[model samples]
Every structure is written in C-alpha cells, then in structure tokens.
Target: MRIVDTHLHLIYPDRFSYPWLATKPRLNWQPWTHEAYFAEAVPLGIETALHMEVDVAEADIMGETEFVLGLPRIAGAIAACRPEHMNFVDQIEQLSEHAHVKGVRRILHESPDDLSQSDLFIENIRHLPDYDLSFDLCLRDDQLYLGVALAQRAPDVTFILDHCGNPIPNGSGLDPWRASITEIAHNPNVVGKISGLVNHCDPGWTAETLRPYVEHMIEAFGWDRVLWGSDHPVATVTGGTLTDWVKATREIVSGASPDEQARLFHRNAERIYKI
Candidate 1:
C-alpha cells in the first residue's frame, strides 16, 4: 500500500537558525534532506511526504516553507507559527499565499500549558479558517483539555491532533489520556494523527505495548478522521527507526479493511491538508 507521511521534518542548518538546537544537542548535527529521506522511504511504499516545521529560528520559518515547497517529492509543508507573537497575523497572511503551505504548527507541548489559553493566541488560531489552513495541535497528554478548548473555540477551523495526543504508554494506558482523547475526538472539527507512539513506549516495547493506544484512537475518531505521520528522527530516540515505526503501524492496522487503512495512511491527509 502507498503512504503519505503527514509529519516529516526537514532540517536546514545553514539556511535556518534552530535556537532550540543548542538544547537538543542530538538534532543539531546535520540537515535531514529530501534525497536521504526518499532513499529510505520510496522502497517502503511512501509515495509522498509533507515537510513539518523544525521549530527553526523565527526569522527562518517562511524561508523553511519556501525551501520545502521547492523540493520534488514534497507534497506540501506545515510551517512553524508563533501565535503568541504580535506578528502572527502577518505571518499567517504571508503563509496563506504560499500554494504548497498546507498547514501550520506551534509546538505547544514544550511550552507552558497556559500558552494556548491566552486570548491573543486563540484569536490568531481563529483566523486560520479565513485562509483555509489547518492547525496541527501538538500538546502533551496532560494538556489535552486545553487542546479541546482550542478546538471548541474555533469550530469552523480544522484541527489535526498530532501523535495520538502524545499518550505515554509507559505510564500506563486508558487513564486521563484516554478520557481526554475521547472528549477531544467528539469535536467534529478535530481529527487525530496515529503517529509518534513509538516514542511514548518503553525502549523495548513490542507491537502489543503500542496496540491499545492506537486502537483506542481509531475507536474514538474512527479511521476516516485519522491520519498517519512518521514523526521520524524523533522516533530514533525510542530505538525505532522510521522504517521500524511504519512497519509497526502497518502491522497494527492489518486487520482493518482496505478502505480503513487507506483513510488512515493516505486519504484523510490528502483531504485535510488539501494536498
């Protein structure tokens, strides 16, 4: 089956400034290029990919989008956005003009919980629908309620929840995270991504360890509203390569009908991102 990776990050150390790189010493080494990615992905049936934002220097965000838009197999890109900043409206306006700029993401999981709650931030996200742009909500398991609030506030805009809401399987399953995800999924405007689970598991986690969370997400949102993302490179931290993660995802969904798998792996993304 073919796949569309909705969450692949492309790094350009020379052209962009990744201030967060200094703290994340491991990711600072080299750029993850399109050629290198295709060399590994194409054979695995990944036909195309969307370039996710690398949290590059604020100045380089647009440049990063333009760079990815220039790549051959890059179907589109999710540009980095800072809703808290005063220039957010201008940034969104400029990003909307880029034909290949499909969506936008601001890494809320790393920031304070109250970040998205601010009136200014919510106001900026409210403007997304005006440009036909979707917001990729990246929040921790504990912060899901806030994510739900954001979704509720902008019911007209589309929201894609990244990484199965970043559930911590190692911490145990079906507790607060499950309830939160279920509530969030109830919002017709919100969708979930069945990606980044490998990083939430124990280092030696097998397919069984990751199954329940993925199953619950599919149950909550249904296959039609869910999408897949590699969350590559970061998956490496959990002792699973992108190929390994993708293989696990494929195995977990093996029992589903072809149409269900098609929605999870490719179709949902094509519709959501307007790719």
Candidate 2:
C-alpha cells in the first residue's frame, strides 16, 4: 500500500547547523539527502513525506524549511518553533505564509521538564490554531502526561505525539506507557505516531518485539488519528534501516482491513497534513 510519512527528517548540515549531530556520531556522516531517502522509501511504497524539523539552529529554521520543501516527494514540513518566547507570533505569522509548512515542533525530549510546562509555552502553542498549523510533541515516555496536559489546554490545535511517547519496546515501561497512551489519546485532538521504535529497541529488534506497542498505540488512538513515519537515520540506528521498519510495519498490520490500512498508511496523513 502507498504511504504518507508524517515524520521524515532530512539533515543538510552545510545548509543548516544541527547542533545535536555533534553528539550523535552514528548519524554524523554525510547529509541525508532526498535521493537517499526516496531510494528506499519509494520502493517500499512511501508515496510522500512531511519533513519534520531536525531542531536546527534558530537562525537556520526558515532556511531548513525552504530547503526540504523544495525537494522531490516532500509533501510539506513541520518547521521548528520556540513557543516559549514572546516573539513566537511574529515567527508564526512569517511561517503562515508558507503552505508547505504544515506544522511546528520544539524538541522537548532533551530539554528540562519545565520547558514545556511554562505558562508562556502553553499560551504560545495555543496560537497555532490561528495559522492552521498542528504541533508535533516530541517528549520522553515519562513526559507523556505533560504532553497530554498541553494538548488539553489547546483542544483546538492538533498534537502529533511522536515515537509512541518514546516507549522502550520489549522493556519494562509498557504498562506505564500504555496508561499514558490511553490518557493522551483521550484528547480528541491528539494523534499517535507508530514510528521510531527501532531507536528504543535492541540492535536486533524484530517485528514481534514491537508488535504489542504498535498494536496498543493503534488501539488507543484509533486508525483515524494514527499516522506512519520513517524517522529515518534515527530509525536506522540499532542496525535497522527504513526499509526494514516499513516491512516490519507492513507485517504487523497485515491482518488489518483495507480501509484501516488506508487510514494508517496514507489517508489519515493526507487529512491531517492537508497534503
């Protein structure tokens, strides 16, 4: 089946400074260009991909957005934004003019807990509805409740929870992650993404290792609110390639009905990202 990847990240270091790459030696090589992604993605039926922001330097955010959206097979972008700042509206207004920018993301997983909890952060996030841009919530597993709380405050804004709340698949956090998944999915505006599990699993992770987490996320969010993503390179860590994850995902949902597969693989993303 054809797929719409809601969480694809492309890194062009020369064009943008990715401060995080310095620590991530595994992904510190040549830039991950569109050619490399579509080479495997197209063969595996990924028809389109939305460029998720890679937390580029503040000055390079707009440059990064323009770069990716100009490439082939890139349907749109989830640009970077610092919602905690008072000047965020100006950036939002500037970005509102770009149809290719479908959403905004501020990486909360590596930051301190209080970063997203501030009143200004929540209020700034609330402004997204004015521009029709959704928010991509990238937080740790234990921080799922924080994401839920933020989403609840902005009920009108759509929140895409990344990496199944960063669950440790085949590990001990399943019960807590499951609870948080249930709680977050209760917000009708939140959608759960079934991507990037490879990053949290063992180097030799199998489809079976990820089956329960994947199934539970779909159960919690339902098909209409679930979207597929490659999360390439990061997903490629642990010796797993994008092709492997795509194949594993196909295997996991092999029993699903055609309409259900359609919703997860592409249809839901089409409606959510307006691609």
Candidate 3:
C-alpha cells in the first residue's frame, strides 16, 4: 500500500538556526534533505511526505515552509508557530496564504506544562479557524489533559495529537496517560497521530511491546481519525531506523482491512491537510 508520512522534519543548517539543537550534539550537525529522505523512503512505498517543523529559529519559520514546498516529492508542511507570542495571529494570517502550508505546530512537549494552558495560547488558537489551519499538539503523556482543555477551548479548530500522546511503553498499560488519551479522543475536533512511540519504548522493543499502545489509540480514535507519521531523526534516538519504524507500524496494523489502512497511512492526511 502507498503511504504519506505526515510528520517528517527537514533540517538545513545554513538557512536556519535551530536553538533547541544547541544542547543535543547529535542532531546539530546534519542536513536532512529531500533527496536523502526519498533515497530511503521511496522504495518502502512512501510516495509523499509533509515536513514537520524542526523548531528552527523563530525568524526562519516561514523560510522552512518555503524550502520544503520547493522540493519535488514533498506534499506539504506543518510549520512552527509561537502562539504564546503576541504576533501569532499575524503569523497565521501570513502563513495561510501559502498553498502548501498545511498546518502549524508549537512543540509543547518541550515547554512547561502550563505554557499551553495560558489564556493567550488558547485565545490565539481560537483564530485558527479563520484561516482554516489545524494545530499539531505535541505534548508528553502527562500533559494529555492540557490537550483536552485546549481542544475544549477551540471547538471550531481541528487538532492533531502527535505521537499517540508520547506514551511510555516500558510502563504498565494505560496509567494516567491512557485515561487522558481516552478523554481527549472523545472530542470530535481531535485526531491522533500514531508516531513517536518508538522513542518511549525500550531500545530493543519488538512489535508485541508496541502493540497495546498502538491498539489502544486505534480503539479510542478509530481508523478514520488516526494518521501516521515517521517522526524521523527523533526515532533514530531509539535505535530504530525510519524503515524499521514503518515496518513495525505495518505489523501492528496488519489486521485492519485495506480501506482502514489507507485512511491511517494516506487518505486521512490528504483530507485533513487538504493535500
């Protein structure tokens, strides 16, 4: 089956500075180009990809979108935004003009728990519907409730939950995180992305280790509401190559019918992001 990677990050050191990369020596050096990505992904059945923001310097956010849109096989982008900042509305208005700019992401997973809960953040998100933009919510497992609150506040805007809420597979099944995911999935405005779980699992984790978490997300969100992403270089940290991650995902979803797999891998994203 064909696939669309809804979350891929492209890093160009010369054009932009990624402040978050300063502390992580491993991710700081390389340029992940469209050529490099396709060389590996194309043979694996990935026909198109959406570039997720690398949290590049605040000034280069639009530049990142422009660079990716210029690439041949790239379908779209989920650019970065700082909704906490006062200029968020203006930024959204400007980005909405770009036809390939599909959505916006603020890496809440790295920020303090209360950062997304702020009134300013919630108010800024309320403006997304005007531009028909969706928000990619990146938060840790514990912060899923905050995701719930944000979804409640902006009923008109579509929200894509990244990384299955970042579940830690080493732990027992569905502690506080599972409850939060269940609650968040109850909201019709929210959708789930089944990516990034590899980062939270043991380095040698097998498909069985990943099954429960993936199955729970599918059960909660349903096949139509779930999408797939590579989470690329970050998945590298967990010792799984992008191909390995995709293969694992295929194993987990092998039981689903052909139509359901199509939605999870490609169609849902095309519809949600209008790709």
Candidate of highest TM-score? 2
| Best-first order by lDDT | 2, 3, 1
Model 3 shows how many backbone clashes? 0
- Per-residue lDDT for 133 in model 3? 90
lDDT of each: 0.89, 0.90, 0.90
- How would you encode candidate 1's per-residue C-alpha lDDT over 1-275 as one tens digit per residue? 89999999877787888887788656677777888888899988899999889898888888889989999899999999999988898999999899889889999999989999999999988998888899999999989998889988878889999999998888856688999999999999999998889877878887788889899999999988999999876677777778888888888999999999999999999998999
137: Cα error in model 2, Å? 0.3
Model 1 residue pairs with clashes? none
- Give lDDT tens digits, candidate 2, residues 60-79: 99998888888998999999
Candidate 3 has a TM-score of 0.96
Q: What is the lDDT of residue 41 in candidate 3?
A: 96
lDDT of 3 by residue, 64-146 (tens): 88888899989988999999999999999889989888899999988998899899999999998888899999998888888
Question: If scored against the real structure, what TM-score would every candidate get?
Answer: 0.96, 0.98, 0.96
